[model samples]
Every structure is written in C-alpha cells, then in structure tokens.
Target chain A: MEFLNQNSLYIVLIITVICWFGIFGYLLSLDKKIKKLEEKINKE
Target chain B: MVFKIILGIGLTLVIIAGIALPMVSNPSSFFELPVVPGLEDKARIIFFHVPTAWVCVIAFITSLIYGIQYLRTKEILYDIKSVTAAGLGFLFCILATVTGAIWSKFTWGAFWNWDPRQTSIFVLLLIYGAYFALRSSIEVEEKRASLSAVYSIIAGLTVPFFIFIIPRIVSSLHPDPIINPQGKIHMNPTMLVIFLSSLTGFTAVYYWMFNLRVRFSKLLYQQQMKEQE
Candidate 1:
C-alpha cells in the first residue's frame, strides 16, 4: 500500500509520456504523408 | 518545417518540466503547496485535462472565424479550413471528455456524475456531431460549404455558453481548477509553472495537427482542380 501510494504519480508520469509520444508519433506519420503528397503534386 | 521542429523541442521540454520536476518536488509537500484533499497524487491529471479542454475551445473558435470568412468571400479554402478546424475541435472535445471522465472516476468515485460540467460538454459533442452530419449530408460543393459554414457559426455561439457559462453558474462537485471565487488561481508556483508549460505545449500540438489537416485538404482540392482541367 505504501509502495502503491508513493509510485502513483510515477505511474501517471509514465502514462502521460506514452500519450504525448503516441500523439506526436501519429503527427509525424501524417507529416510524412503530407510530404509525399506535396512531392507528387510537384512532380505533376 | 521550422515550426514543427520548434514545437517538438518545446513539447519535450514541457514533458520534462511537468513530470520530472513535479516528481522531484518534495514528496511530502512541494514548496509548502497544500495537497488537495481527495485528489492527492491523481491531481496531476489537471495538466492533461485542462489543456485538452482549452484547445478544444480554441479549435471551435478557429472554425467560427474561418466559417465567417467563408461566408464573406465564398473561398473554398476558407471553407476547408473551417471544416478542418471543426473536425479537430470535435476530436479534442472527445479527448477532453474522456480524460475528464477518467479523472472523475478516480476522484469522484464514479465514471460520470451528470454534473453540469459533464453535461455541458455532452451537449457540445452533440452540437459538433450535428455540424459534421450537416456537412456530409450535402453533396454539392457550394451548398455544403455555405450550409456548414452557417451551421458552424451557429454552433460556435453555444460553445462559450456551454464551456464557460453553464459550468460556473450551476453547482457541481467538479472544482474550478483554473480560477477561484476570488478570481485568482490558488496553486503552488511550481505546479503553476508545469501547468502553464503543458498548456502551451498542448496548444502547439493542436496547431501542428490543425496545420497538417489544412495543408492536406488544400492539396486534395488542388489535385481535384488539376484533374478537372
């Protein structure tokens, strides 16, 4: 119980990091797609 | 491109400041900051919950502005921006609601309480849903853009009422985290710093996503024009 109490915020921190990176990763992939589309349009 | 790189660096700094610094804060009571009753450690959710809710409103307001621009100029680009902003607003609205519900579950002992805050956000989701439905139901480009712009404008009017007015005027278990009755934030300095950093970081995230959607949609519109020519 003591361990759980102390580590609760740590767990929250880990989860927050995961959520941040997850969203950032999605945005990165979308950026790649947008770049590809930009390239395609330029070629045309 | 530089904007994206800058935003990424800023967000990394935000995560470090928010999580790392807070964790290292004197566990007993960081800088004499009173531990919120019943919230304890779970209170950290404030960083996530508030920012998501704030960005949701920002996106809706952006949609409203672009919607008005579309009506004035009849530019398809403005209409595209308006819809993209609304789409992103809806996404963030759902995120805020879900995160708030989870926080409520841990703090309030129920996943939902039908409290004024929760109810207002529910109404907001419904309004956004209707806007999307209104957009899709029309097949004609001019009709769709004009009609949805009108719908977005009308819907935007209710956003302030639901998000700001309703929650405050009615009684609820949800504490006013941002401001107090005295109109001042009652927060520790370190906590406030972290919260503000997270707020800026999340706002940047919203802009990054919103910019990507607008650019992508613009590309699609140009492609269609080319094909037609």
Candidate 2:
C-alpha cells in the first residue's frame, strides 16, 4: 500500500476526479439546455 | 430493464475484482511486479481507458450510420442524430486522450511523448474538432448537416487506423508484446471475467448516454423549428 501513496496515486486521484466531474457536468448542462428549450416551447 | 440491471451487477463485480486483483496474494495475482508495493497495478485503467475508447468506437459507428441515413432519407432527425453522435464521439475522444495521458505518466516517465500512437490520436482529435467547427460555421441547417455528415464518414475511417494499426506497428512502452499486439489481453480467468464485466457495463452506459444526447438534440431542433414558424 505504501507504493500506492507515491506521487502517482495523487495523479490518479486527480485524473479520476476530473473524469468524474467533467463527464457529469456535460451531461447535466445538456439536460439543463434541453429543459430551457422545452419551457420556452410550452410558453409559446 | 433486466439487462440493465444485469450489466450493473456485472460492472459492480468487475470493479470489485479489479480493485481486489492487486491485493490478492499468491496464484491469485496475475503477474508479480518488481515495482514498489501496491503500485496501483494499471489493470484498473482498463476500467477507464478501454471503456472510453470502446464508447468512442460506438459513438462513431453510430455517427456513420446516421450520416448515411441522413443522406438517404434526408430526414432532419437523422441529420440531428448524426451530428449529435459525432459531438459525443468527440467528447469520448477527449476522454480517451486524457485517460491515456494519465496512464502514460505513471507507466512511462513522461505524459506526452510524441510516439506514433499518440501522434495519431492527436490527429484524430484535430479531425473531429474540425468537423464540429465546420458544422457551427454553416448557418443553413440542411447545408450544415450535409457537409458535416460527409466529413464524419471520411473521418470515421481514420479511427481504426489510428487505434489499431498504428499501435501495432510501433514499439510501445505499453505491455504484452507476444500476446496482445491486438490491444493487450491475456488476463487470467479471474481478471478476464472482471474485464469482460466492465466492458458490458460500459456498453450499457454508452447507450444510455447516446439516447439522452440524441433526444436532447431532437428536442432542440424541434424547438428551433417551432420558433421559426
């Protein structure tokens, strides 16, 4: 487990965090944009 | 629904096994390493890197199919589908690049070596980036769809060459020269089960994403049309 604590572990954690948030953020933004469009359509 | 549930279970099991593989002792360990203890044994990256590339392959295949459909039927839905798939494909490409970069940093001393495989992926990114730029530049919907579809078909052909062919020809610092020239495998039965499980799980996730993106694009397109009317 000691080897896991080296600099690479930090690097991997950073990569994983970036991957997690980046993907979810895009998905959420796309959903939000679609919802706004739908709301506008309903108003019209 | 059952299939999705099964895939979820499979992904869970695979992830557990992947996490356990390095920790397991004796014959359970796939191959012993001389490196420092518990070096994060790279098999975990299979959960990430391979899955991203698989999703990208799936996305481009989808783009090409819809590209042809748009050309044949001239249906706006198909055009929307093609562009949406390409857009998602580009995102997957970026994901794959980042994952690969991180993996390289650990295995290789540096992250961005100008190796043949790396160079080709960079080129692939350029090709897809240009595709989106081409779409955004054109104001006319039909014209944008037609040009982007054609470009997508041409660009889709580059994927196999970059992902498969170039990697084979070049001497990589990667792994498994004798067994895995065709994208390293040869995991023991236990590891193989875990790897396959992850692949199935990711395929489900990919479809889920594709469905959502295509639906969003269709909705947006319809809304735009209504506004015009």
Q: Evaluate model 2 with DockQ and give the value.
A: 0.19
For every candidate, what is the interface RMSD in angstroms? 1.6, 4.4
lDDT values, one for every candidate: 0.83, 0.71
Tens-digit per-residue lDDT, B99-172, candidate 1: 89998988789989899999999999999999998888999999999999999999999999999998889986
Which of the numbered candidates is closest to the native, going by highest DockQ? 1
Per-residue error (Å), model 2, residue A27: 6.8
Q: Which pairs clash in the backbone of model 1?
A: none
lDDT of 1 at B225: 90
TM-score of chain A for the candidates in order shown: 0.80, 0.67
Write down the worst ten-residue block by lDDT for model 1 chain B: B23-32
iRMS, candidate 1, in Å: value is: 1.6
DockQ numbers for every candidate?
A: 0.57, 0.19
| Poorest 10 consecutive residues by lDDT, candidate 2 chain B | B31-40
Q: In model 1, how large is the Cα lDDT of residue B55? A: 95
Question: Candidate 2 local accuracy as lDDT?
Answer: 0.71
